[model samples]
Target: MRRWPRIAAWCVAALVLAGAALGSATVYFGWYDVSATGPHTVPVYALLDVASTRSVKLRSADIDVPDLDSPDRIRRGDALYRAQCAQCHGGPGQAPEPYALGLNPAPPPLVTSARERPAAEVFWIIRHGIKMTGMPAWQYRMTDEQIWDVVGYMRVLPTLSPQQYRDGAPSGGPASSLASASTSPSSSATATPPGDMRVGDMRVGDAKAGRAALQQYLCVTCHAIPGVPGARHYVGPSLDGMADRSRIAGVVPNSPDYMQRWLMDPQGIKPGTAMPALGLREQDARDIAAFLQTLSNFE
Candidate 1:
């Protein structure tokens, strides 16, 4: 027994010595390629990708999400994004700015990243900002609606093209957004904005009223989120769980006040925003904000 124990300790020591020797050789012999041009090996890249996604998702778990599918919200989002985000993230048409590509860990194309994330995760990154990366948190600069719009656009980016992105600028070139819609059902809480600018808290009991207001106002004609069973259309990001987000444009701390302010003048928060001044009243803005807040009850 004593001999076996001694032999086992020697074997362990030998293994450690061999590992250190191998490591020293790898470093001294230039066996490990450190070139940027060399892409990661398949297994290495796969492991890294898994780790990256899990890290983002874990950090994103606490982030509350708002509704990303409304036209007003997305339009406002576009406005803020064009001014700040487009340079790095790019859009359907615009390529990433030079700086974004040159960074060590290249900025993830949001259009592609969305497929891997929940809207809340996207919103969290927008609000909290990432470290050692080109991405910045919009917190303090933009409103909630604006962030949701970017999230909404991201949800359906796979279907966009460079031309559509250029045209989709809210500045009115031609191509407008056509991102994917969430399949989640829109509850009474996720009511659409009213036609005549009536602003107020949405009542679950008044879902019928909210639905009526949605159609009468032509809200669905151009913008469409998942609403009342089976009527979903791809006009906008689905409003499956809008009420839960913590901020807007990944900037503003989510609040009814900020939401209303954004609806009235999204451009004030971000210059060159695509969202137009919609001529909204205080109440109109509030009512719409109320409806949008309901999109993420699940999150």
Candidate 2:
């Protein structure tokens, strides 16, 4: 019995070592096909599917599900889905765009996913997205309320016929509400005056818009940004007390133009810096710079 136990232990150790060696060799020698044109082998696909499914289930286990039967909420989700999701995932009447078709492990139709997965799992997937897949993390671009709306809409997606989908949510619905809400200033949050700050000759950079833009661009992921709700990570230095700093990235003078330039192309000014060039649009760079400038201190 003692001898058998020892043999079993040795066998397990050998197997672990062999698996490690195989993984290392595969990575180093480029033995795995990474091409999107090629589909994953049966075992590989099965393993990945199981892993992703389990991860979503575990993470979403504790999520509090809201009442998704509200007509307003469903309508909002319908509009949002048509605008943001339909192109990639398709809908009752629609096919995914040509580009979405080219993606490896192609984006699944939400109609099927809605029927199969729980609402919490679907919500988590939409908010956080999956790795090594084309699904984007919508948390960056959407609020929690918005994500929930999408989930609500998805629940009803399977029930809609092609004609009903085409007809869309009734007139004077979520679309109009969304438009009005966007134009109207928030009663709670203080509004930044339009063109309160300028970058170069252009009168731009609304602080309120800038703050939202910061969240949209995933800046909160790596840095501890004030006012933006996200993980308290410090992969990059905190943006607090940015206004007190005289230099941008310890290189250029901390002026609006220089700050915008840095936001647009971090690598261009400082070669080999860990900060990636996020391919920010000119207006987005200006907006980000404006938001950073507002960070006076850690308080």
> Candidate 2: deviation at residue 23, Å?
2.5
Residue by residue across 143-254, what tens digits does model 1's lDDT show?
A: 7666777777677665665545655666432223212111123311133424643335433323334433333222332244345321122333445555676766566877
Residues 39-139, model 2: lDDT tens digits: 56656766887899899999999999999989999989988998899776666534455466556665656665676789999899999999998788999
In the predicted model 2, the residue pairs found to clash are none
Query: Of the candidates shown, which would achieve the greatest TM-score relative to the real structure?
Result: 2
Stretches of candidate 1 off by over 4 Å are: 1-44, 129-133, 137-146, 170-299
10 residues in a row with least lDDT, candidate 1: 180-189
